[model samples]
Target chain A: MISIPIGEWFDALINWLKDTFPAFFGAVGTVIDWCISLFETVLSWPHPWVMILVFTGLAWAACGLKKYGLALFSLVGFSLIMGMGLWSHTMHTLALVLASTLLALLIGIPVGIYAGRSEMGERIVRPILDFMQTMPAFVYLIPAVMLFSLGKVPGAIATVIFAMPPCVRLTTLGLRQVPHDVLEASDAFGATPLQQLVKVQLPMALPSILAGVNQTIMLALSMVVIAAMIGAGGLGGQVLRGITQLRIDIGFEGGIAIVILAMYLDRVTHALGSRSARKQ
Target chain B: MSDDQTVIEARGLYKIFGSRVAEAREMVDAGHSRAEILKKTGATTAVVNSSFRIAKRETFVIMGLSGSGKSTLLRLLNRLIEPTYGEILIDGEDISQLGPSALREIRRRKYSMVFQNFGLLPHRDVTENVGFGLEIHNVDESTRRKKSLEAIQVVGLEGYENSPVQSLSGGMQQRVGLARALATDPEILLMDEAFSALDPLIRTQMQDELIELQSRLHKTVVFITHDLDEALKLGDRIVIMKDGIIDQIDTPEGILTNPATEYVATFVENVDRSKVLTAGSVMHRTPALATHKDGPHQAVRTMQHEDLSSLFVVNQNREYVGLVRIDDAIAESKKGGRSLDPILQRDVPTVALSTSLRDMIPLAGSTALPIPVLKEDGVLAGIVTRAALLSALSKESGET
Candidate 1:
């Protein structure tokens, strides 16, 4: 039996890439840092109550304004996070999630559309999406930290890679789910490929694509704790500190804040997705 | 190649679906059977050697049962499915080898198609779906809306313009599909079993509406159907397809009266010939006629000479007058009457040359004399005797 040195070869490849493209990685890090800070300033600079009101309004609108449940959930959930003295940390975690999920969608949707349109495109993209999803989040952090160094940018990059598969997969599913006869109708009408995609495919796929966005946001939030190990400060950092210092109370407080944030975000995004589904 | 009035001319059309299209096509051309070709080359030749010409403003129907290639043949006309080997000429230009952009241009400018399933966008309102084609052509918004509304009116879906397609009934949804196809005002309309999904009552109403629309619009239509009656009702000429080959191409009456093959004969075996065969196709040419100018003596002599009980009287201009029986003519002649009008029986039923045998049957049953079939100009073209009508009905029924 022959023993393979795949891990050794992969390590050498990573080192070579890091050494070869320092400038490229530095530019990417700068861009990532800029987006994350922008989100953080917007979220935290405002009084926490004002942000809570805004979020509650969004929930109200998403749930069609008659239902007050999601709105009330957001109001109470954010107040609890604030009362725990974890408001700023929660905002930072949210900023990281929003930025990473935004980046993931921007990259995922067009690639998904391409993959959905052609057999060859799908065949190549399917395995890449699988690898992105099934590979452990911590493994991505190593290469990301090596490339961009231990910072919020590297954590954000790792979070983006971990969270993007759902976006790509769901978008592809949406495009595929459009009926073949509808596609024939479009072709019969002399629609250009671009016209067909924008006018017919994208609108029909909206519900599924928005559902993908919800999944991406949830995955990004899950990455917060692992992201803290690489010096990205947020609720994850507080949780890490609580763990290292053996303070059960502090760890539990951080954990409660994360749960409240996840619950609120899920309701808001899920409402929007379901509303679009009804439209389709 | 095409003459002036030819809207579409298909030459040697073949569509073989499989990985080895070229091999399959060769096998098909070499006279191999479909099953044999499929087994040998892993290809199913859906449409084989289809060729025909469709004239402008003509409703040409392609009819076949399931798996008989009618739908595939319809798609090939517009190049929605590319042919493995063939030429489709639109007005004289071969569309088979045209590039993608050129084909798209032809589709936009020359052809608009409706589908069996209605193929409407569930998310869109009726107006938006109808306006889709105009928008694709970059028509200005106001114009597109106006044209869309006009098309909606054309399809009798006026009030449902702003309603979402999903909210409408299936019949109304297909109206939107029809309006969508009509919005572009293309020269040709391709309908692939467009009414098959509708209920029978709605399907009949749609067919009547289609016929009325054709009378008004004069658009060349290529329709496909599996229903024999639908093909008979809508087609000016129908091509019967079987096992990827055209069994016959003929008028509804021609298909019924003179089936080109045993397959066609079997296919049309159950059709009601009385409804399809016209009086012109069944009537007999009159042997001799008595003119109204001539007296009853001439009528009696002609009736006697032609060995007939009655003679149809005509004017000098060959206008139909009436039928004069031999007994009435002889009695009038014995009474010394000079004219046949006083004794002629005008109550005999008259029909147009184009009247269906179904209509002539009732008239034939009622009348003792031969029913006169008049031309459009009011001249007696021929006569449908009771024997002829029954024979026409029973004659083809026995053979088919």
Candidate 2:
């Protein structure tokens, strides 16, 4: 095949990026505004320390005292450090991750069920799924900004793009791995296909699908930090401000807050997953 | 036996698995053999032109080695899988042409099946699993639970109602499966190797429990198993299959004594048929009368006291009279000396010097005495235990 001219290829790339940029920026801006509003709502209520203590108590009940103590200490220390720099931004970042992850789950699961049941659907969707998963987090901001303009919305859109793949992939995997004998048993009982899918297949596949949800949450948390460039105000903005102004204290505080938030969400979700798995 | 009503009938049933199942069945029924049909239609046969009728409350067992298509045959009866050709009639009504809704109605009310693997849902507790069918049929929860609890008690699993099925042992899980089937109280119970997965001891226990349950419920059962012993023990009549074709269909005694083919003979060879036969195998045809004045019950009581089947049923004259069966004597006593059908001299079974216990052992449960050791004058010198014939056969066959 004849090679395309380097200048032509570069121009095509630039054109494509320019076309997608506004949607990308726009999604980021919308997400950032939502995050700021969520933080304001949370701030208008009880203190962060009180909520942290309640969560620590829950963790103690779920995972025992040692984990609870460690989690509490980490939360307090991380919050104090972030407080010295920008307290509200850290809370906004936590809200951004939570909101984006919830949105990813809503969209991912039904699509996964569709892909799992039909071979043609899986064949058609898998390549697109692969592309979404492997595309750089920074690259997602381009399309988000193009659609939603520069704000929290663009950031949330980019975070969702970056995070949703795991949920879809895991749900598909779980459904595919459901035991054939178990399916046959349901069929033998005169269960219609829909009843079998809803009652038998989904419940059996819940553990694996939950694992997907956990992964998506973590991925969204990381990507929302990257979305700070599109005027998304959060701990990510603090870290970005620290980098631009060369303020070491602000960067360290923001980074520590993100770690604390990640640990809290992960522990809570995992505990729920295991608890569900243990139930009849 | 001829007066017994038939409850289920299948005519020229064919379950051919391929694109041209209809054509294949036509070709086979039109004088072409299985091989010839296969060559023409390229369809694999599952139940090849098989047909049988099950009488009401009959424990009909389908015995076959794995892949012989006994399971396929059972599914065909309930229409779990449709047959390519044939008509199935339940109580003289053709059910093969029933639509999905009608078929579902039939299944919900008329038939239930127990799977080999004990198909209790893992996520549901025992009570829920047992009541699942009842729930699907729209039985109210309170009624279903009450019925399910009774079924659980019937299966001897009373305390395990709330336990998740995954936590139960294999035999317990199987009992739950049985309870689920029994909970519905359908007219027919179809078991597909239901006991074969259990340990031998557990299998025997389940078999005994099943017999007891059948005795009480009198549900028409079609049990499928590869074990000949199980078939003999549980089946009122057994149908043995080989490669989708039925090789034999008869009572255990009928099949054991007269195997239809070599394949069936091989299956029966290891069976200890003597255990199944009863003490009535060898009674004296003509009993000598005693000096005591009495009827058949009194004669039987007198004889049973001495462990004999053929004793005198006589009047005050002390002349020789008819023989009395010990069983009939016992029956009369149980009924407060009420008259029961007594064993006559003609009704009793007798084996001569040339006879084998292999033939006589089956009559042990009947009115005949234990095998009688006869004198040349045909007088009852002594009686042989059913065990004696078995030992003799064992010695002759070098199986002792």
DockQ of each: 0.78, 0.28
* Weakest lDDT window of 10 consecutive positions for candidate 1 chain A: A271-280
Deviation of model 1 at A226, angstroms: 1.5
DockQ-based class of model 1: medium
Per-residue CA lDDT of model 2 for A1-280, tens digit only, reads: 9986976775577567767675764464555566557755775356767755665666667665555664666567556744675556666777778778878888898888888888997998799899998877787787566556687777888888789988998899888987764665555555666777887789878887898898998898888778999987788888888899999987877887787777777876787677667874
TM-score of chain B of each: 0.95, 0.75
Interface root mean square deviation for model 1, in Å?
0.9
| Per-model lDDT | 0.90, 0.76
Per-residue lDDT of model 2, residues B36-90, tens digit only: 7778889877787788899999999999998788999998988888988888989
Off by over 4 Å in 1: B1-4
Give the TM-scores of the predictions, in the order they appear. 0.97, 0.76
Which ten contiguous residues of candidate 1 chain B have the minimum total lDDT? B1-10
